[model samples]
Target: MGSVLVIGSFNVDHVWTSDRLPRPGETLSGRYSSGPGGKGFNQAVAARRAGAATRFVCALGGDGGGDLARALAADDGIDLRELRSEAPTGTAGIYLDEAGGNSIVIGAGANADLSAAFVTAQAGAFAEAAVVLTQLESPAAAVLEGLRRARAAGAVALLNPAPANAAVAADLLAATDILTPNETEFTGLLARSTGTRVADDAIAATPDDRLHDWCRALLPHGIVVITLGGAGCFVSHADDARRGEEAACYRLPAAPARVVDTTGAGDAFNGALAAGLTQAPAAPFAQHVRLATHYAALSTERAGAAAAMPSAAQLRERFGELFSAG
Candidate 1:
C-alpha cells in the first residue's frame, strides 16, 4: 500500500437544526453549531483514519476559519505541508431537517481562488501517491490538471463530481480511473442545464432503469460508481474492447446504522475506497467496495463531518463482520 493524496477545498460548516426545511422566502429559527467540513478535508480525514498515509493539498484563507482548518488537519494526522493559504477560508451555511436530510449553500471564497499553478506546484507530492482523490469544490481546470499529472505518475485518480457544475471537461472524465456521484449529481451531469431532477429515494429503489443508462453512457470513458445513499451503491465497468454491452454491474447495500448527520458521507466512501484499494490492490474489486461501505456506515454513526470520522480500529470493531465475510 502507498500514500493517498487529496486535492480539494476546506471549509467551516455552520449547521442549523430544525424540525423541517424552510420554504422559499420563509424564515425559521433553529439551533446552530460549527464544525470542520469541506469535501477535501472530510475525505482526507476519512482516508487517514482508515489506516492510510494521507496528505491534503488544498487552499485556505488566512482567517479564523483557516486556523480551525489547520488545527483539525493536525488532529487527524493528515499532512498539511501541501495545503496552501490564499484568501479567507470558505464557509457553508447548512440546514438539517428532522429526518436527517440537509440543504447547503456554499460561499466559495478562497476555494474559488485556487489556481492551476498551485496544483502544478504540488505535482511532486502527487507523484509520490498511489491514489489521488479530488472533487468539484475547487476549479475544474486545476482538478483536471492534477489528474493529468497523477496519471502520468502512475497513480490511480478518483474523482467525485459534486455541487453540480457544467464546466467539467469530457477529456477529464476520460482521464479518471473512478468517478463517483450521487443520484442527483449523476442526473445533473448528464442533463447539463436541463434542470432535470431525480429523487434520491427513487434512484435507490429502482437504480437499474435510470442508473444503468447513465453508467452505460460513461462506460466508453471509464468506470462509474453511482451512489444511491442508503440503498448502497452501483458499480459499472466496461465489458470488453470489442463490445460495449460487455459492461458489468453490481450493487451493494448500505451498512445499517443509527442515522445522524450525513454530511461528508460520500466523501467518506470515496476516501475509504481509495485507502482500501491501496491496502488490497490485488483483491477482488468487490472486497474493496465492501470495505468502503463499512467505513461510510461508521461515519454516519456520529454527528458532524470530520468529527464523525472513525479510526481504523473503530471501523474494524464495528464492521469486522462485513470485511470478514468479504
Candidate 2:
C-alpha cells in the first residue's frame, strides 16, 4: 500500500442525542457522549482502517483533548510524528436528532492556529506519500501550502472543502487531483445553478442540462467528485470521454445498511477513495468510487465519527463477501 498523509484538524466532539432537534430557544433532554472527531482525524482513521499506511499532520492544544487525540491516533496506528501541540486543541459540539440528522458547531481553537509554515516544515513527509489529503478545518493558507508541497513532492493532492468557506484559493484547487464535496459544498463552489435536480434517493444534485455548464466552469481546474450521501456519488474526470464526448459521469449506489449516524460519512468516503486509489490505481474510476461507497455505508452502521470508523479487518470481514461473490 502507498503512504497517505492527512493534514487538517483534530477536534474532540461532544455529541448529544435527542428525540428531535430543538427549535429556537427550545431545550430537550438527550444522551451524551464524547469522542475523537474532525474531518482530518476521521479521514485518517478511515484510511488507516482501509489498509492504507496513513500519517496525520495536525495541531492540538496542550490540553486533555490533545492527549486524547494523540492516544486515538496511536491506537489507530497512524503516524503522529507530524502532529503538533501548540495551542489548545479544537472541539466540536454536535446534536443528533432521532432522524440521524445533526447540527454541529466547532470551536476552531488550536485548529485555527495551524499555519503555512507548520505545513511547509512538514513537506518532507509529503515526499514519502502517494496521497496527501486535506480539508478546510485548518486555515486556507495552510491547506494551500500543504497542497503546494504535496504537488512538488509528486504526490496526488485530495482536497475536501468542508464547512463551506469561500476563502479557498482557486490556484490551490487547480493543483488538486481530486476534489470531493457534498451537495452544499458543491453548490457553494459553482455559485450558479445549472438547474440540476436532486436525484431520487440522492443526497446531491445531479448534472442535467445545467451540469455541462457547471463542468465547463470547473473543468479547467481539477476532477470533481460530488458525493451524494445514500444515493451514491457522481465523478467527472479530466480525461473522461464524457467530459470531452458526453460528459463523463460515474455513479455508485450506496451499499445497503442501517444508518445510525451520518456525521463523518463524507470523510469515510474520501478516506476510502484515497486508500482505494492507492491500492488499485489501475482500477476503473467507477470501481474506486464503489469501494469508497462500501466503506462509507459500513461507517454509517455505527454511531460516532472516528469510533464508528471500521478497521481493515472488520471492513473486509463485512464487505469482503461482496468482493469475493462478485
Candidate 3:
C-alpha cells in the first residue's frame, strides 16, 4: 500500500474521568491515567492500525515521554522521523465526563519546536507518500512546509485545522486539497477567512446549499468535510474536482457506536480517511467517508486517545461485512 505521511505533534496525555465536567474554580475527584497522545500521534496510530503503511514526522524531547513515543511508533510499525529538541516533551491534561464529552489543555513544549527546516529535510519520505495529513498542533511554518511539499510531490494534501483557535493564513490553506474541520473549527474558519459568522451549533441545521457555499469560500479549489459529531458529517467538493463522487455536496449519517470517550474521534476520522484514500484510490469519495465515519465510531467504543483507535478487523466486526470491502 502507498504510505500516508502524518506531520505534527506528540504529547503525553494526563486524563481525568468524572461524572461531569468541572465548572470554573471547581475541583472534583476522578480517575486518573496517563498515556501517549497528541492529535498527530493519535491520527498516526489510527492510520497505521487501519492497515496503512504510515510515517509520523514530529519533534521530540530527550525524555521519558519521547521514549514512550518512539516505543509506541516502533510497536505499531510506523516509520517515525523525529527531531531531538532541547525543550521538554509536550503534554495534555484532558477532562472526560461520563457522557463521553471532554475538554483538553495542552502544554506544547517540543511540539512548538518542530521547524520548517526539519519538514523540508523529509523530501524523500514525502516522495513516497500517497496522502500527507497534518494538523495545527505544531508550528505553522512546519505544517505549511509539509503541505507545500505534499503538493509538490503530487500527494493528496489533507489539512485538519483543529483547536478552533490556531492562526491559519490564507496562503497556508491555499495548498490544501482536502480540508476537514469539525463544527467548531468550521465556524472559526468561516469567521476568520470569509468574515462570515455561523454559529457552530447551527451548522447541522443550516441548509445544504448554504453550507456548501461556506465550504467553497473556505477552500475554493479544494474539498471541504465538516464532521458534525453525532449529527453525522457533510461533504462539499469544488465543482471542478469532485474526486469521483456524483454529488458536489451531501451528508452521511453517523455510524452506530457504544460511547466511552471521544477524545480521539476526530483523529480517527482523519487517519482512517487517509488510509482509505491510499488503500482505495479508485473508490468514490463517499465510500472513503463511510469508512472514516465507521472507524471513528468504533474508536469511541474504547477509552483513552491513541490507545482508543480500533483496528480494521475490529471495525469490520462492529459494523458488519461492509468494511471488508475497504
Candidate 4:
C-alpha cells in the first residue's frame, strides 16, 4: 500500500474546559488538561486510526514536548520523520465550553523552522505517497515545497488551510488538488484569491451552482470541500468532461454525534477523508466525504485532540454498514 504522508507540526495543547468561554478581561475557572496536538500530528493520528498506512514529517525541539510527540506517534504505529531544531516545541492554548465550542491560540516555535530544504531532502517520502496532507502551521516555503513534491510525483495533494487568517501563496494554492477549509478559512481564501471582500454568511447561503462557479474561478483543476459545523459539508469538484465553466457539487447532512469537545473535529475530518481516499482510490468522492463526516462525528464524542480519534475496530463495530456496504 502506498503511504499517506503528513507534513505538518507537533504541539503540546493546553486545554481548559469550562461552563463558558472567557470574555475579554475576564478570567473564568475551568477544568484543565494538557496533551499532544498540532494540525499535522492530530490528522496523522486520525488517518492511522482510520486504517491508513501513514508517515508523518515535522520539526521538533529537543524537549519534553517533542518527547511526548515521539511517544504518541510510536504508540500509534506511525512512521515519524523528525527534524530536530533549537526552538522549543510548538504549543496551543485551547478553551472549551460546555456547549462543545472551542477557541485556540498557537505558539509556532519549532514548527516555524521547517525549512524548504528539509522537505526537499525527504524526496523519497513524497514519491512513495498515495496522498500528501498538510496544513498552514508550518512555514510557507516548506508547505509550498511539500505540495509541489506531491503534485510532481502524481500523488493526491490535500491542503487544509487552517488558522483562517494566514495568507497563502498563489503558487501553493495552484498546486493543491483538494482544499479543505472551515467557514472562516473559506472566507479568507476567497478574499485573497479574488482580491474582494468575502462574507462567510454569503458562502453558506449561496446556491450550489453559484458556489461551483466560485470554485471554478478559484481552482480550475481541483476540488474544494467547505465543512459547516451542523449544516454538514459542501463539496465542489472540477469536471474534466465538461468544457468551460462546470463542476460537480453536493451537500451532505451532518452525521450524528454525541457532542463533547469539538477541538479536533476538522482535523479528524481531513485525516479520515485522506484515509478513505487512499484506501479506496476507485470509490466515488462523495462516499469518502460521507465516511469522513461520520468519522469526524464519532471523534467529537470524546474529549481531546489526538486522543479522541477512533480506531479502525471501533469504526467497524459502530459503523459496520458504513464500510461494509456500497
Candidate 5:
C-alpha cells in the first residue's frame, strides 16, 4: 500500500451533547464526554484505518492531553513525529445538537508552536509519501512549508482549508495540488480569493459552472473538492488536468447513512480520499471521491472525532456494493 504524511494538530476534545444548541448566555444541562480530536490527528487516524501507511507530525505539550495523543497514535499504528512544547496541549470545546450539528471553539496552545523549520526537517517523511495532507490547525507558516516540501518531492499536496476562519495566503493556495473545503470554508476562501461572497447556505444551489469558475479562480492550477453535507460533494478540476475524469466538474450524492454525530465527518472524507489516492494512483479521481463520500457518511453514524472513523474493512462491509476495492 502507499503512504500518507499528515501535518496538523492534536487536541483533547471536550464535548457536550444537548437536545438543541444553546443561545448566547442561555445555560442548558447536557451529557459531557471527552476524547482525541484535532483535525490533523482525526485525518491521520482516518487515513490509517482507511488502509494507508500514515505518518502524523505535530507539536504536543507535557500534559495528559499529550500523553493521550501519543498513546492513541501508537494504538492506530501511525508513525508519530511530534515537537515538544512548553505550552499546554491544544484543546477544543464542542457542542452537539440532537440533529448532530456542532459548534466548536479551539484553544490552540502547543499547536501554535509547530514551526516551518520543524515541518521542513521532515524531508524523509515527505519523500516517502504518495500524498502529503495538511490543514490550517497548525501555524500558517508550518502548513505552507509542508505543502511546499510535498510539491518538491512530487507528492500530491492536499490541503483542507478548514475551520472557515483560518487565514490562507495565495502562496499556500498556489502550492496545493488538491483543495478540500466544506461549504462554509469554500465561501470563506471565495471571499478571500476574489472578493465574491456566496453565503454558505447557498452553495448547494449554486450552478455547477458558476461554482467551477469560483473554484478555478481560487486554485487556478489545482483540483477543488467542495463537500456539501447531505447534498453530497462537488468536484472541480482544471480543464487540462481532470485526472482521467470525463467531466471537468461534477457532483456525487452522499451514500445512505443514519446520522448521529457530524463531528469529524469531513476529516473522515479527507483521510479516506488520501488513502484512495495513494493506494490507487491510476484510478479515476471520482473513484477516490466516492470512497471518501461513503467513508464520511459512515463516520456520522458514530460519535466523537478520531474514534469515529471506520476502518477500510468496515467501509467495504457497509457499502461494499457501492465502493469496490481500490
Candidate 6:
C-alpha cells in the first residue's frame, strides 16, 4: 500500500437549498449556507476520511476563503500543499432542490492562477504517490503537467474530467491510466475526442458487456469507470496488453441510502477509489470500486460537500460489510 496525492482546486461553496430548481427568468428564495468545497478539495477530504494517508495540492487565494481552506484541511488531517496567488480564493454557487439534485456555477479566481510550473516544482509528490488524482477544476496546464509527471513516475494516474461542459485536451485523455466520468462527461469526452456523439444515457441500463464495448470504443487503453447514480457503476478494464475483447467489465451495485444532497457523491467516489487503491493495491480492481461506491452512497445521506464525507470510522461502521477486509 502507498500514498495518494490529489492535485486540484479549493473553493468555498455557497449553497441554497430550495424546494425546486428555478427555471430561466425565475427567482426563488431558499435557505443559504457556506462551506468548504471545490472538486479537488472535496476529493482530498474523502480520501483522507476513507482511511488513507492523503496529500492535496492546489492554489488558494489570500482571502477568507483561502484561510477557511487551510483550517479545514488541518482539521481533516490532509497533507495540503497550496500555492498563494494575488487573486481571491475560488468559489462556487450551488443550488440544491428537494430531490437532492444540484446545479453549480464556479468562479475560478486563484484556482485559475495555478500554473504548470507550480505543479512541476512538486514533482516529488507525484513520483512518491501510489495514486495521483486530478480534475478539471484547476488550470488545464497544471492538470496536464501533474498527470504527465505522475505517469512518468509509474504511478496510477486517475483523471476525472468534471464540469463536462468544457473541452478537454487530447494529450490529457491519452495520458490517463484511469478515466472516471458521469454520463454527461462521457458523452462530452467522446464528442470532443473522436467526434462521436453517443447519446446521453445510451447505455445506462445496459449490461456490463455493452458498457465495456462502448468504453473500449471511447478509450482503447486504460481503465474506464462510469458512475450511473442509483444503477451503480460500470468499470471496463482494458489496461492489459491483450486484445480489447479480452478486457473484463464489472458492475458494482450502488449502496442503499436515504438521499439528501447529491452534490459531492462523485467526488466521494473518486477520492475513496484513490484511497482504496492505496489501501489494497494488490486486491482485485473491483474491490476498490465497491468500497468507493458504498462510501459515495453514504455521502449523499448528508448535506454539504466536504462536510458530507464519512470519517474512516464511520465508513467502516456503515459500509464495513462491503469492505474487502471484512
lDDT of each: 0.79, 0.78, 0.94, 0.88, 0.95, 0.88
Q: Which candidate order results from sorting by lDDT in descending order?
A: 5, 3, 4, 6, 1, 2
Residue 121 C-alpha lDDT in model 4: 88
Deviating ranges (above 4 Å) for candidate 3 = none
Worst 10 residues of 1 by lDDT: 238-247
For model 6, what is the alpha-carbon lDDT of residue 110?
94
Which of candidates 1 and 5 is the stronger one according to TM-score? 5
Predicted model with the maximum lDDT: 5
Position 317, candidate 3: lDDT: 78
Clashing pairs in 4: none
Listed per model in order, the count of residue pairs whose N, CA or C atoms clash below 3 Å is 3, 6, 0, 0, 0, 0
TM-scores for all predictions: 0.90, 0.90, 0.99, 0.96, 0.98, 0.95
lDDT of 6: 0.88
Ranking by TM-score: 3, 5, 4, 6, 1, 2
> Taking the tens digit of each residue's C-alpha lDDT, what string does model 6 give over 1-326?
67899999898999999999989999998999999999999999999998888889999988999999999999989888999989999999999999999999999999998889998988768767989999999989999998998888888889999978866888888888889999889888877776777787775876677767778877788889999898888888875822233448877788999999999999999999999888877777888888999999999999999999998688778866567433
For candidate 2, the per-residue lDDT at 31 reads: 98
After the best TM-score superposition of candidate 4, give how far the Cα of residue 234 lies from its true spot, in angstroms.
Answer: 0.8
Consecutive 10-residue window with the lowest summed lDDT within model 5: 317-326
lDDT of 3: 0.94
Error of 3 at 130 (Å): 0.3
**Model 3 Cα lDDT, one tens digit per residue, 175-194:** 89999999999999999999
Query: Where does candidate 1 clash, by residue pair?
Result: 61-87, 61-88, 239-246
